[model samples]
Target: MKKIFTINCGSTSTKVAYFEDDKMMCKSSLTITAEQLKEMPKTLDQLEFRTNQVEDFLKENNLDPKDFDIVVSRAGTIPSVPYDGAYEVNELMIASVTYAPEAQHASTLSCLIADKLVKGLDVPVIIYDPTCVDSADEIAKITGIPEITNMPVAHLLNTKMAGITYAESMGKDYKDLNLIIVQLGGGITLGFHDHGRIADWVYDDEGPMSPQRAGAIPTRYLADYCYKSNKTLQEMRMYLCGQSGLVAYFGTQDVRDVEKLIDEGDEKAGLILKAMAYGVAKSIGQLCVVRGGNVDQIILTGGVAYSERITEWIKEKVSFIAPVTVIPGEREMEALAAGGLRVLNNEEQVHPYIYYPKGYSSIEDIINNPNELA
Candidate 1:
């Protein structure tokens, strides 16, 4: 039987699991608090620390890291790759992620951790559907700003797997279906999968408000605030991506706490949550317009999809577009394992990681940028 080890690193936690063929053998997670994060500001600085934690987890679970025939992980900050699939971890990929100072996320450590786990062992390390996966249609890449072509970046890991899961359930291939995947979590994004390629996607700041993300805000107002409010770019990012949304209103990031507040007759909390759902519904309606209203399925999957309140609200609004499938939680481990199993079973070819620092797969060859920015 083939052995697979999956690693999923979030902002504050590292989740690792072991699998034999298709059956999971053991799983564990190591969590770090905000205080702990503050001690190590750089994402790569925590690499050795996280890799050691994974080794400890293996020891505690009586699973040897050396015994892992294949190691797969959630990709973090790689330069934009053209397609979605598994890519073998290599020096180019590692250096691209490590050197990208502006894009250092805690999740970026997962690739480093995956690389470290099989240092001496001849085990293959791969990452499935990284954040940089760009399979959107060429027209979708264009925007008002030329240099700032919005490359397809969303919750590719969970959402793509969810699409495949729903497709198989209906006895259809993922590439043969027109689907809209709604990824609701700490960060919310929607992707319009036209047959196989991700035709387009709604990004972080242009979608519904997540539990933490502020989502789509007025561009004119945001620009005015940036100039008048005297907040730095980093501070503004923290506001929109970290301290905004439900947390900005309720002083908490957990959806469960927000639900409790709603249950306790807090009209304000209830209103905000409902508004979030309303925004999600509106976003789904927008994506349906991508293919001229020929959506086959709409799958709501992610950590937040488990919420009956939000899902029901979205369902009431988007059920008319297509049949909605609720596949709650980010099944990244399973997806990673499946990707590894494909490599092991020779069902798919694994590509070597290539770095494209300025974001590859541009729709147009010539995009003017006098300042050479973004």
Candidate 2:
């Protein structure tokens, strides 16, 4: 029996899973809090801290990395997908991630975890269905941003994976069905699925002015505020991504807290909650347009999807679009493991979805001239 380890590093936590013969044997999620961040190692020193944590967990559980046939992870966004599905994290991909960076705490953490595993055991590390920026040709043309590929493709991939599992249980292939996937998480990612492939996706930049992010702010208004007010970039970022959303609207970002306030008849909280649900419903509607109004199922998945309040609101709004179902949490670990095994089994090929900076012909060309920009 071949064993595979799927490592997922979320923005706030790390999830490790062990799979044997495509079956998830064990899974663990270790959350890292702000207080932990204060005492935790910086970027360069994080490898030891991450490694020790995983090593201790495995030892206590009587498991070893050597037992695994492959190691898989969720990597950062590269550039653009040449096609679709999963891919391997090669030197080119790694270099691209290292050079042209984004706010990818999970991807960086995953690298540290993978480094530890590869050092202890000579296993190949693969990344599955990373944020594929494969915007439809028309969408790109409309957006006028060549880089604006479908940002929610990864959500679509995982949602489709879940759909297949659900369909298989009923002795049906997902390929024969049309589906809509609602990803309610740190952000809302909606996708239209046809025959198990992601046909189109619509995502809200930030989450609904939830307890966390300020959601989508009008760029012009934001710019005016920045100009009129004297605030540092960090301050603005914190307010926009963290404080302004539900916290700013209410007193807290916790959904439970918001719900409590709503139950207490706090009119303001009720309004905000309704607005968020409305935004999600609006996104679902946009996805329907992509499907040409032929949606079979509307499935909801993600961390926030667990909220009954949010789910109910979505269901009521999109009922006519199709039947809506909620699949709480994400399947990134399973997706990673599946991708790794696919590559190992020759069922998929590894390719770079991102291009090197400096507009170079290849990764080697960029590497050979590090001073090109200079």
Candidate 3:
């Protein structure tokens, strides 16, 4: 039996899980503070304050990275277009995430770990969704952003993990059933997975407005707001995704704090939370409709979905669409390890990732379009 070590990096934390002989033997999650993030550690010393506990846990468990057969992870990205799940990490992924046009701190950590592991270990290291952008040309043209066609299916792993777990719990294989997974994060993402593939997905550009995110706002209003604030497009984006959303609305990025305020009769807090739930329901409805309204279940995941209130609200909204199940916790690490195993065993075929220019759908469009860069 082989041992697999999975690492999942996020904006403020890192999660590691170890699987041996077909079972998860240990897991560690390390949380980091905003100040710690601001400093941007360039080495393991910089990561010390945050990961000291994790290092200690590993030491206590007598675990060694070198012992693992493979180290797998989900890499961060800049949003683009439609992509299928599963990919092998490459230099393109490394550069995209590490030197992303946008300053994505999560990507920084992923690269740091990837570099460290590949150099230190003899095992194979796989990054599934490292800033993948594989979009169809048609959608890219509509958005007028050529980079929109770069589609990385990062979410596929987590959604499928949730779906399979929920299905197995019900004595079924996910391949035989259709599932709609509503991930309530800074925004709400509705995805449909059927027969072992992602059929369709719709993400609220405004998100479910989390404790740290302001879900989608009216584009016009946002433009006006940015104008009034005299913020550039880059700054506006940073605020929209990183700062202004939930933190601006509620003064805290922790959903638990917001929920507490709501419990304390904070009307504004309650509204934002409800708004997120409504958005979630709406997205789920759209995905269900896309799947001909025969979704077997709606599985809710992500940080925000942990709240009982949010889950119940989304449940109420999706009750008519399908029976709803809330599977909290992001299973990114597990998915990566399992996916690596599947790919290694040749039990599944990894899809070829195609990076199409922003505005074209097919080869013809790319070749014939008058606007195409010559």
Clashes of each: 0, 4, 18
Ranking the candidates on TM-score from highest down gives: 1, 2, 3
In the range 1-374, model 2's lDDT, one tens digit per residue, is: 77888877654567888888688988888676756655652332344666667777787778877777878877664565645666566667665555443443344557547755776467777676666646453552245466653344445546766787667766988889888777666556676677766667664453345556677777779889988877776456545754576767765656888888889989988888889888888877877877688887888887787789888987899999888877787777877777777777878887644555436557776555543111
TM-score of each prediction? 0.92, 0.83, 0.79
Query: Can you give the lDDT of residue 233 in candidate 3?
Result: 57
Which pairs of residues collide in candidate 2?
79-354, 135-150, 210-246, 211-253
List the lowest-lDDT window of 10 residues for candidate 2: 365-374
Ranking by lDDT: 1, 2, 3
- Estimate every model's Cα lDDT from 0 to 1: 0.83, 0.68, 0.64
Query: Per the 3 Å backbone cut-off, how many clashing residue pairs does candidate 3 have?
Result: 18
TM-score of 3: 0.79
